[model samples]
Target: MRAQRGLILLLLLLAVFCSTAVSLKCYHCLDPVVSSCNMNSTCSPTQDTCLYAVSGMQVYQQCWKRSDCHTEVIMNLLEVAKVKFRCCQFNLCNKSEGSLGKTALLGTTVLVAILNLCFLSHL
Candidate 1:
């Protein structure tokens, strides 16, 4: 009965972890003189996406909403006639370069390892 309760508790914890909505993390910068922005920030709950935009020589990297990724909307926001931009949903994805996909993968691996240990201990 105790083992069953432990399993139930573990499952509940996993469920809560998966269901929790974590705020988006993004790189925040506007009109940076350098080619890269080193500043990082946590986005608000309503901001579900990371935005990277370029207008002429100016660069912008910040949090945004998934619904507002339109070209006209960005143009109006930046007050530029011509602009190029991309929106992503991952943390720090607004950088000028390099892949940061390992964070989630590493977390999942650690969680799986911990769960395996818990199960093995019961057996």
Candidate 2:
């Protein structure tokens, strides 16, 4: 009986962590900056990924389609001579915020697991 309860709690916690609250989001910047960009925008449903690019002193980050995540496509679209690019598919996953979201999620997951274990202990 306790094992069943523990398994149920674990499944519930997994569902909570796996669900998406909203559409994808990406940091939005098209200017020269020395570090991470602070601005962001929620992506349209069609925009399935976040794009991050750096060219010389300038940085670019925005919503992008996963199909168009190639260097040549992004370069042509952004009109850059040479640029480095990264693409990802999660909230602010262009990493403008530097994994704070992941850290928060990890912390929340740990807290929930602890509480669930405590609750199960009494059952």
Model 1, stretches more than 4 Å misplaced? Answer: 1-21, 97-123
lDDT of 1 by residue, 5-108 (tens): 66886898777654443667899988658866788999888888899888888888999988989999999877889988888876677777444456556767
TM-score per candidate: 0.64, 0.64
- What's the number of clashes in each of the models? 0, 0
- Worst window of 10 by summed lDDT in candidate 1: 97-106
Query: Ten consecutive residues with minimal summed lDDT in candidate 2?
Result: 13-22
lDDT of 2 at 76: 93
Residue 106 shift from truth in candidate 1, angstroms: 9.5
